[model samples]
Target: MASSLRLLLPLLLLLICSIHGGRGQPCSTSDIRVEQRTTGASVEGQPEYQVTVSNTCDCPQSKVMLLCYGLNSVTDVDPRAIKPVDAKLCAVAGGRPLSKGTPVKFKYAWKTPQDFPVVSSEIHC
Candidate 1:
């Protein structure tokens, strides 16, 4: 009984480690493409836009992280206004899974006038 218990304990530990280790490693930056487009036009000093992330890899991706920053020489608009379309799915705890050729989108609105366009954005999985 003692020998069997010892063997089982190591196997259990290995199984647990493997399960946890396989998570949190999102796809590489090179495997994804991001694009931004204006939804319509600036409304009442605020601008609305949509950002899309496309998976270029052949496999499915999970736990994706997206960070977008705004750039404008005329005005200083808060970049944090850009948010995931689905807040719950894009939360830090876990992100939505994206399959190959599929894309995920986020919507953003600037509180102030955005004279410049979004020139910098990043993604990680």
Candidate 2:
């Protein structure tokens, strides 16, 4: 009985690890994709750009923060859509969980398009 139990335990542990690690593919900042394009509109003499943030992971991601140092738009954006966390980061969707297919979008006006790289997120599988 003891021998069987020992063998069973190791197999069970391995099975659990594989299940968790293999399921849904572990997500990270790389799973977040950012796309920005000119909207052909001007705000306060600055060209407007539309930004879309999407989670490519199979699972939902929450608390999605992006690098946004020195991000200032002459056009006003809703705080709930995106807000500054500090000098170097900003949170998206009010830090709510983003679904796989649904994307969060917002627009800003500037002389140049701002780049938003994913900084951190909590992946929910």
Candidate 3:
């Protein structure tokens, strides 16, 4: 019994370490790139923007989260009116994984008062 216990102890430790090791390994920020474009005009008289997230890593990226916010007329945007733009790609459960060199694209529309003019937007992954 003592001999078997000793053998199992190392195996158990190895298994635990393997399981937890991956949790510490997150995808590198440098491996991803975010690109933005204005896809024509808004269909419903709103401002529309398209964002693409590309994975430049050699490994697959899973459950990636991207947040986007839009600002209209930098100086005049109403504080109460500020809100996150639509994240079309964010609707996927557990995030949509991308293979190396692949890209994911989404669109967002900002609702602003007439003549508010969107000046800039920000995205973070």
TM-score of each: 0.45, 0.79, 0.44
Q: Indicate which candidate wins on lDDT.
A: 2
Model 3 segments beyond 4 Å from truth?
Answer: 1-27, 69-94, 111-125
lDDT per model vs. reference: 0.49, 0.86, 0.48
> Tens-digit lDDT track for model 2 on 42-114?
9999999988889877778999999998568997887877899899999999999987788999999988888
Which residue pairs come into collision in candidate 2? none
Q: List candidate 2 stretches off by more than 4 Å.
A: 1-24
> Candidate 3 residues 1-125, lDDT tens each?
99999999989877755643343343464555666677676745766765556766445655554443333322333222133336322221234456566666555555542222222222222
Better of 2 and 3 by lDDT: 2
lDDT for model 2, please. Answer: 0.86
Query: In each prediction, how many residue pairs overlap at the backbone (N, C-alpha, C within less than 3 A)?
Result: 1, 0, 0
Better of 1 and 3 by TM-score: 1
TM-score for predicted model 1 compared with the true structure: 0.45
Residue-wise lDDT of candidate 1 within 1-125, one digit each (tens)? 99999989988877755643443343454565667787786645667766666667545555555443323213333333233334222221134455666676555566542322222223432
TM-score-based ranking: 2, 1, 3
Which one wins by TM-score: 1 or 2?
A: 2
